[model samples]
Target chain A: SSFQNIVETSYGKGDKVSPFNVATSYNNFYEFGYGKSDPKDRSSSLKTAPWTISVEGEAERTGVFDLDDIINESVLEERIYRLRCVEAWSMVIPWVGVSLASVLKRFQPTSKAKYVYFETLYDPKQMPGQLGGGLDWPYREGLRIDEAMNPLAFLAVGMYGSILPNQNGAPVRLVLPWKYGFKSIKSIVKIRFVETMPETTWSMLAPSEYGFYANVNPSVDHPRWSQQQERRLPGGVLFPNVIETKMFNGYEEEVASLYAGMDLKRFY
Target chain B: MGQYFPDPGKLLMRLSGIWASVFVVAVMAMTLIGKIESLRFVNRYRRFIGLAAFFYSLLHFIIYLILFAGLSWTWIASDLIEKPYIYVGVLALVIMAILAVTSTKPMMRKLGKRWKPLHRFMYLAAIAILAHLWWQVKDDVSLAVYFSILLTPLLISKIPTLPVYKHFFKKI
Candidate 1:
């Protein structure tokens, strides 16, 4: 709906509108339904209350954490950051959340912990995509122990200062700003501290296409397209595609040390 | 040459039409091969070679007419005058447009002697369009590999009776 006015008024000969940005912000996580608008409509039916996160694996305190216990005394801070997708588009969003380290510290990682694995709430009844075999379903993702400990990594609870919309991962989710969007699993219900890499949904679906460290690096391109440039969302017609993507999406100074000596091309 | 076979040239035109049909079907079948699968099989689906070349040329014309010129006759004349890439793209589009328009038995029969030479222009158009796409992308090497796969064989296929034709004859 927001795009209609932009398209009608700002798009014409030499008007400078880009179709790329429209495709980015208006994504249909077909796991939800079809059309760019389906996620917004069908996602509301998702029940987030009475949620329980099963915290198991290598954590010292292994038990279910109710949604209330997860967010108690949690101060939500609005952090404005650039979200670049693997699909070549980006958005500047103000996310509201407390650090993931704060949440993880509550349980305490055991010495055996080498990675943090998260599982999306897997109700085949609620998440329609779970009904099919596009992914292993339940949408799984993980991060290296050190990467999970970074300050930029947040266990996001809200966005735009209000509680998160269902479509935007209500109740709780991961927000690793430096990595690809998938790494930030939404509607998370399970957190595991594992000794090895977790089988991520997209990576499991196509191991060669996606890797564990799916960071937003301009220098290393996806096998299908270049990540060097990106289309900035909701720009005026005359200016849409912004030239050059920044390293770590301009968060390199904050997150570069996390991957100090690794090869981004192979890791990506 | 005309007196030698008294319409041997018509045979070549009909042959080109058959070749074009075979090319169309092959490209259609190739679409089923997913991106990852395309990487695994070098001979995955060569038919999409001409199909993508067809779309790029179609997009080139649409951009000039709908996006750039706004279908304004006055604007098109000025655009064809000023933009070098647009002019080259239009030339490629014109050649593919002719091949597309005349890719039939009756049209092939009517065009006769001119068909073979006219259709040969498709090879050049494919190269030109690929070059046009390659030059437009800033740093995305993925697009380069994509166009390279489609163009390299189309360019090589121009060598009429080479062993590559053995691979080409086996459609998608």
Candidate 2:
């Protein structure tokens, strides 16, 4: 289904958006599978209709809320953003959604709500890759309250002027452009506003390799690979389109202050 | 297969790497299994399989150099410093190339007694390839674990004094 009132914004205007076919086909939605094309091939079985998100912990209006109700309340806008994967690949995507802060504020998060946690749906029948032990099921991610409230943090429902493809986290997903792509968890089913720092899936799996603050800093290399550069997608074998990676994925001006005074190297 | 893949370079790299490892492991398996009368004929094809392993490894190396590193010597130089697994992978490739070059009938005849000791370096190449597999893994170790399970028995068979090896070969 296509979106009705998608107000286009000047987020990634000058940047080249990756080919829609390439962007949709190449994905890392591990719930569908590990191979880059697995999600595109295997996610057709996922049922996105009648989806509901369970809002829990430290929020006043906490309960199961229908996805349509949440989307109807917000004014959807197209925000073109650059998505940098921890694996050193990047894509420019035009995502349609409202600010995450707009959605969370409706819940009236209490003073105790210092962090916001998100989880992907966990149905082995629909998401076959969950059958494999690649990760702990129900892939979870989180952000600090301040980060969640950041203008850059978006709760995306659609992309490319339409509802999201099932492989691309159909129905709902987070789009934290400044952080690594994995932090933008897909097919979210739960949102919890908690006081303590929430445990994120990748960080829990390999703490040394993936930090909680997965801000795209070129200076901080993954234990196994360099983060100094990235290959922009639509890249060919001979012409790889390798470019120097920017600090905070070129969003340092917007998000750098969020980590002010804190040791980014240590936090990373 | 190329049509299905979004990044053919990455697909080709993985395919060549996997096939190289498969053939290398098969050569080691053939050495022990060839002891049986019914399977002894398999020993004659060992050189062909060994060559196939070298061919695949060469393809894997070329893909890494051209597609992955974009033929940039500076990038490769920096990669050698940052990623230690590349060192082991290069070592394995170099060993395979030497073995491939010496596999001809004339080289085999000239080397005579020295050939057996020199060819034993294939085992060292196998070790290096295993190290290359395990070291670069980001999260999943399943592929490395599977290859290890396939290789461990063949490696142990090389120990002449082991009672298990003696028992297995006694019937043949």
Candidate 3:
């Protein structure tokens, strides 16, 4: 069936909410020992009931937001968005949550706050990936002030009209539709508002490979592969695994204005 | 070569098996290197530097079937087809596979008289594999360059063949 046909068949034409584009975009970084399909298997070990986020740095109300309180306090809405990975693969996901701007508003960052840094849950006892140090333990990501404030930017609570799977960033995770997939930090535990740019996880590891912004632009090619083409997830045998990538992943209406004067070639 | 095998078809199948065994050994070595996590393990990357050659040969053989024999069987056979470079890559894999399998004592004992001639297939396989990789590269030449650097010593070691090439070059 065509893309429109698939969407209409799954969700009624008038339905405001739709299912997340379901595909096992495998994260097989097996250093975690949870196995190749650990995201589906071992993520059950995560305890999401008593969660808390440390809101620190330039925010005026710097304190902890209880997991339950955070969920109850915010408004949740469904936003159909495209997720483009740096590896040249793409997926359309229907996320449930309110704007990131609203979440930041409650914390009330000071005027000096130019960037927002997010830290994932660091407990190695629970997140097995952290147990063995392939990365620096707790994965960190940051967003520019304008990028965070964009209405399209969301603090996702649910996927596929249900609660998020632990592997897909359960409880709450940021989803920046315009930027590359890494900008959407998963299993968030800390939110820090900072004056200077915070070091992002992939960028710190290989600065040349991963940029600070990490936006999805067709013109900007990765060191190893071209970003000009993408393989839409769950492609059929007849369809082939290549598609023309669009600037901002076709979210030009909402995000093009943010990077008006800056050069994407240099910033990319 | 055809005299020992008798049937050309059987020879191809036997050749394919040899290639598979070589691939298995290389994969095992890579797995061991990944687990060792020592300073020597970092140096062990060279153990499987030419993996793309194997993958390319596997792809090449698969595509030949799809494009030629399986052209009419699109629905069932189309699933077997692969990307272009991947299709052209099987020659490398088959060569590597033979080299790996014959590296064993029992296989060497079985093909005592023909072992040397069989090993010569590696040269053809290496060149075909490089060509396959070179054709598939779109914009990034780094990956091709990496493979080229890895194969350089392997190619250069056959210095005696230079005279045959020099004779061919004079004719050209």
Best by TM-score: 2
TM-score of 2: 0.92
In candidate 2, position A180 carries an lDDT of: 94
User: What order do candidates take by TM-score, descending?
Assistant: 2, 3, 1
The DockQ ranking, best first, is 2, 3, 1
Count of backbone collisions in candidate 2: 0
Of candidates 3 and 2, the better by lDDT: 2
Tens-digit per-residue lDDT, A153-250, candidate 3: 88877766667777787778898877888778888999999999999987887787789988889887665445766655533333323467889887
Model 2 per-residue lDDT at A69: 83
Model 2 C-alpha RMSD to native:
3.1
The number of clashing residue pairs in each candidate reads: 2, 0, 12
TM-score for each of the candidates: 0.63, 0.92, 0.64
Model 1 / residue A228 / CA error / Å = 0.3
lDDT of 2 by residue, A1-268 (tens): 7878778788997899887888899999988887888899999999999899999999999999999988763489999999999988888999989999999999999999999999999999999999989699889999999999999999999999989999999889999999999999999999999999999999998898888899999888776667888777767746556778899999998899999998889998
lDDT of 2 by residue, B86-129 (tens): 88999998999999999999999999988977887888898898
DockQ of 2: 0.35
